[model samples]
Target chain A: MFSLLLQSFVCCRFLSSLWLSQHSVVCLLLQVLLTHITISNSQHNTPNPTMMKSIVARAYSPFCSVFATEDCDKLANDLGYEDLITLLAPHGDSVGRATVRDSQGMTNTYDDFAIRLGAKRPTERDSGGMLFNPDAMEALLREYIGHYNSDDSAFARFFAKLVAAPPDTAFETFSQPAAHLFCVSSRNAHPLDTLQALAQGQKRDKDCLNFYVLVHDARVEDAENSTQRTIALLERAKKRFGLAGMIKLGQEGVPETIPTPQFLTVGDELVNLKTGVGFGSRTLSQPDKESIRSLLREFTVQHLIPHMERCIMTWDTVAAGKRGLTGRMFSAGKKWLKFGGSEKQEAGSSIQASGIYPQGSPEQTIRRLADYAFMLRDYRYAYATYELVKRDFLSDKAWKYLAACQEQAAVALLMYTTRLTEKQRVEVLNPLLDSACYTYISRLQLPQYALRMLVVTSDLQCLLGPDAASQGATQWFQKLLDERLVGRLGYALIMLRVSYAFSQSPKGRKAALWQLLSAREWADANQKGEMAKCLDMTAPVYDELNWPNNEGTLLTRLKGELANEAKPTSVAS
Target chain B: MSYYLAIVGTEDNPIYTQEFGTYRQGGDGNSRFSPEMKELAPFILHAAIDMVEQTASRTNQLYLRTVDNFYSHLVSAFVTAGDIKIMLLHETRNEESIRQFFQEVHDLYVKTLLSPFYFVNQPITSPVFDQRIKSLAKKYL
Candidate 1:
């Protein structure tokens, strides 16, 4: 305390000796300072002050406030924050921040909230546009200070807080996901303007990182009304975009580690399984969907899953009689989407119609949730969800999407599962991967896509993985020809694979020609028709310089066959 | 010859490290270190810091040739003007090639320091620098 007094004494000497201000105002300010010190000594007994030293410097931030506006003018009556900013703007792209040191040492640091308030006279004078004098300005400040001291005690308190606050603090923040909490502030405005501009400017930067917008507005009075208005505006945006603000609970309900999923919009149409209600008002654009997908991936990783784990722990403790079951049983037990239920009304469950989950049937919701699990690299969860959903989607009609899901599940398990033993391959993985191939060809009619998945995913990793996918999977492609299920494209695909396989061998030449003959025989009585497809396939892709000599010669023969077939097609058309 | 190269900052924190074996023979550029030697490599380099400080204080020469040794492991030191110490632990010794390797790395270091994203006295995470150090070890070490 004595040291602080001595430091202030030295600063007072520096204030008078160094500062280029008028004499009378300095004397007045000194008197005000002395009274402030006496009041501070009597009113509070504290050690850690974060008080200003002899050096007067300020740090710039994205949310830094100058407090210069019509409202600010009415409060302090000059160009606000100009003097303080001019006095203390530091040198670096990286500015200093303020740390909120509680009795517990360092609890928080408002790096973006170190607001500097200032007031200065306009450069131009009203009387004949004459140059202003420093003496008159000093008198105006003196009168303003006196007025501030008498009627508006709140304004004086704000000023006192501003003066006592430290300039810049170091930057050390939690590395949360991009879509957690977005902070917005004005470039050059008062606290009121900064608050409004931050909200307004944030709507323009279109970043998908954070969902919640936190505004640091100046509130001298009617604080409740200001907060209500802010929330109302956010609520309106939420309704428009099918956004949901997670139901906020009191201190005990909300965990400190996981950030609250606030003001998040459902970028895609989502449905409820329990209530059977489709809930989406608007569709996000393509790029918006991409960004939202990334944000969803990050948020599920950062916040949602952690919160889910906490809830699960609560459930576990309740089961063990360590804690009673909470009245709210979260969305875990709630069937997220209803596939066939049409009786349940929209208003039955508040959560079911909220559009927080992705829009689909129960199966789709499971698939999407599994995908999110896959994206977060929780393969076990994904595999479990996929296993459950795959049973319901075994019908031939849902082959396309179901096959896609099955493939994703296989890949996810391949990456992270220690459960997949070599014994398990014959019993489990082979049948699953075989079905993934069979469904695509026989049911979905997209043979090439199925064949590629077989070739690329399973066969290449033969050395490391089981031989079941490698040796057994090739029969699916051959079966397309054997069962007479293949079209022009499928035949071409098989031949191409055969040629690619033998391209390096001494018998590569015979194999290519023999495969061509085998393709024709598989066409049965329609060898001519199959031959035309083979010609059509190679003609479009034929390039003299790009193709190898042996493939070139075979392609040349196909060109001849194509020309002969085209002559008749011209007559028919 | 197997070599372990480490770039240590003024505060004795590691900035970058790489291990490589000789490409002179028909050997692949994989460090043929025994399990114990691989574990002891970092400690052997660290133990040479006292010798480095003693030599650094006495002479203005940045290059301190064959400063310290532990059994078969020979440690060489190169100190920059800014006090960034670069040390290399090798089973076989060659002075001229070591100086050339240090010079090339120093150039890369200067360029790396010029990057605005880099903070002072931090661990080097640049993959390009890692690659360069490995290639330099393969070439000279």
Candidate 2:
């Protein structure tokens, strides 16, 4: 067959380069000849290439959940390397190349392709179910690479298969509809007030956050229930706020499932909420209020806009930002892809790459998937999706959006994901890299985001090392501390987080205690008795949240502060 | 314009300290610092070490000219091949003259290190070394 001639020519030319003993050279060359014959013979024996292509394409597409492996198969099966080039040309994304010089001063050329699947989000006026999923195309690329090759050939094929896919979104490949988020609770309930405050606070969003308050239906089973007073209080409160459509579980108007337990369903979080809503217009600590405001403002920007923009997205390469590789690159998906018109002569139309996707392909599906993840409280998935798009868009607005995503991702890591493996914790669950990116906020001239990032580092374990500080947490803390615009109590809270991040070991715990005491000092300096009183409450709450290895001294101090509320004096002094 | 010159060793400890004033515009070569300014001059110079350490890793320049500013005062630094640091805190803005003074000081430092009794990062207490730095300050400030 043709492979026999290929084996002979390749061996004769590469024989000297192989640098084998005289006897082994002939032996290796014969082995190569035999292997080629076996492979070519099997391929020739298989009938019907037409049925094979469809089967291969169907198996490689995003919808296919199963993977089949052949131990000794070639890396590029029915889909060779050149077929990938053809895939890009049809979509009109620019096919180009760039040559980079390594540290050794040698230049090597690379196929640099930049693509955007769902960048143009619909404006805020109209957000609907018709969303474009960005990961659909990335999933295709991963599938083609993962399925085509034998295990040993993977190392050789990985570079060619490299695609900035969002983490394996193939599981929910059929774009599902958004689930409604509604709350059910009784009136005069502290948790009800919090949900009401949250609903009123975020009304401007107008998209998503269906924040329904459902007072429990009264006179259950012919007046056997004495829960009538709580219902009446809630009903009066609801009428005062002009809220209609109160829902009860299994009632006609209510959603089958209630999301966000903090809003609905009475909980322990409400026990402390009797004092007040955490965020409001009347708070004297203006900085804490402003910090919370900034957090909410960013939340609206991320949650609302993407929800609306899902309708206007384009899968074609024409919609991609023509600009790439402009600023300090915080992530991948950028390169000087095209030099001039002469690029076609080099790669022949074969290995050419583009950011374009064919119109019917899954790549243009909903970016709303990320927004959905965030709203669903699946921060890990939200982090993955945001990282996918934010790398492509580093504009001032998008970068700030990325900052919000990072902060939320960090919060998700600390609150959840403790039970995962160390490798899983570091890679999928933790936002340590996002913390590194948080320092870039200063470059964007948003100091509030920098302050938020410092607070975020409280969740990062000390084992993550000093790079977390050098990246910007410590430097920004020093900068903000010196400037002192952040409130005294808020500053104390941030310091608490930073000190906690550094206190995974018992030896470091002593130093962390001094930091906690200093937070109380700052609270006292601000002259806010409520903040000073509430400062110690963090330890017991954090303990209940199952955060690891907290110092016992912090709890004792908090309990003492709560017990001494009548006198309000320093426990030791 | 005034100058506060310091020679910092590899361990970030100060090996030398001297104060000088503008010799240009018919000014006398004496420090015009108030009692408070004289004390704060050292603090300003030390605060700039972080800035020096930051900028040093970015470039190979021997004279890291005017890397940090504290209020009205500006700080400049020079890093030697021996990893020693020479810092200058002043109100002046002439980079060329400062570079010239740094090159001369670097030569003098080389000559001082040639002595057998001296150890690296040891306090540079020789009166002759002090006199040479003062002359450079007169020529540059």
Who wins the DockQ comparison?
2
Clashing pairs in 2: A115-A355, A121-A309, A122-A309, A131-A366, A132-A364, A132-A365, A132-A366, A133-A365, A133-A366, A187-A234
**lDDT by residue for model 1 over A37-124, one digit each (tens)?**
4553222111111211111112111112222223322322121222222211211111233333221233344332222222212222
Which stretches of model 1 miss by more than 4 angstroms?
Answer: A1-365, A392-405, A416-426, A434-456, A459-470, A476-573, B1-141
Range of the 10 consecutive residues with the lowest summed lDDT in candidate 1 chain A: A169-178
Question: What would the per-residue lDDT of candidate 2 be over residues B35-127, giving only the tens digit for each residue?
Answer: 646644554565466668778989988889988865477888999999888998888687998899888998999899999999998888999
For residues A1-573, write the lDDT of model 2, one tens digit per residue: 344567676776587566756777677677777785455222211122222222211111111011111210111122221221111111211112323232233544433211111111222221111111223322332332234332222111211111111122221221222212223344223635555564554324222333233334332453334255545655665565443233222122221211111111012112213333311112112332232233223322343223423422332121233223432241222233433674532211111133222222322232344444443334454455555544333322333334544544554454333344456545753444345344444434444444434433332322244443222334344444554524444445445434443232212322233244444554455433333433432332223222112233343444455456645465545
Best by lDDT: 1
Q: Candidate 2 chain A — worst ten consecutive residues by lDDT sum?
A: A63-72
True contacts kept of each: 0.00, 0.00
| TM accuracy, model 2 | 0.35
